[model samples]
Target: MKKLIPISIAILFIAVIILFVMQCNVSKECAAPAGKAETPAIRADGTDLTIAYINTDTLLLNYQLSRDLNEELLKKQEDARTNLNQEARAFESEMQEFQRKLENNGFLSRDRAEREQQRLINREQELKDLNAKLSNELMVRQQEISSQLLDSITIYLKEMNLDKDYDLILSTTVGGTILHAKDGLNITGEVLDALNNRYKKKK
Candidate 1:
């Protein structure tokens, strides 16, 4: 009995040492991301935005649906790009002509140079403004489409919550909260599928 007692005591001590070593090797996992992970999303105008982090599916479906609905807007946006390119070529041509006239000693009268420069500047500004307007319009239309799609997804998510029996669902907003998220938890693919199905029906 005495011999058995010493053996058991030594075995128990070894087991405890092994467990301690294992615990030391792994620190406790953090509940959320650390460091730069804390950064938030913000708009160009400095508006703090929030996106309830979603899965790739959500984005994919949203893109597919919007592409379907905004076919005309998409075409128009492309046409605007074509126009910008053409306008840029025209601007370059005019600039080259002005330079050539100067090089030929057909020196532009200060007044003519000023007038030409002003015309080019004005044309450049118009092109910029037009591009900005088209970009804004496209963005607005995209947001509108996203809003409509999210409305339905939000409803489905609520429904999913009720039946799936999750204790809680967590995600960060676009910028004010939740800068990063872990994999696995991202439901983007599932969301995309749902969105695709929804659009598939609408189509």
Candidate 2:
């Protein structure tokens, strides 16, 4: 089975959030610093613009929901592959039988031989169509799982931010746009813990 691409939810969510923040700042007539600063950037409101980051790679790997969904997907892929393989083997066996019948002159007439040949061809096409359909279904299922995971994380983050403790929350992953950030700013562990606890309660 072909491996599904890892979800890059961090990159996507971060890009959108950054754009929204920029728009908000522009509306408030807040001027961003011309250069990078060692400390957290101050917002237009004069309070410390608290920024925290979540390492999405870590979060996904540790989050139970993600792991369960991933495992389920893998199992589904395996089952699809197994079924396809079995059908393919059956088709191959039929082809071999047809070849044997042709060699042995077992067909009563040319028309019958042609009909069997056409039948085999049709079966082959059916197998190809089945393979394509299964692949597409698996891809769709993977996308749906990814969307669910993203929605869960987004909802949790929205709730977590109700207190307005962090002015900006960013997401980072390995080899992501955020190359470096302070240890204090990395809230991956805290967020992961809370998310897992919430998920546990739900189950």
Q: Quick one: best TM-score, which candidate?
A: 2
List the global CA lDDT of all models. Answer: 0.50, 0.72
* Clash count, predicted structure 1: 12
Tens digit per residue, CA lDDT, model 1, 88-110: 78878988997888678665477
Ten-residue region with minimum lDDT total, candidate 1: 16-25
- Global CA lDDT of candidate 2, please? 0.72
Which residue pairs clash within candidate 2? none
Residue 178 displacement (Å), model 1: 12
Q: Write the per-residue lDDT of candidate 2 for residues 1-203, one digit (tens) a residue.
A: 33333432322332222211322243453344545462347655444566778778788888899878878877777788888889888999999999999999999999999999999999988988887888788778777877787788878887887765566777766887679887898888988999999999999
RMSD (Cα, Å) of candidate 2? 4.5
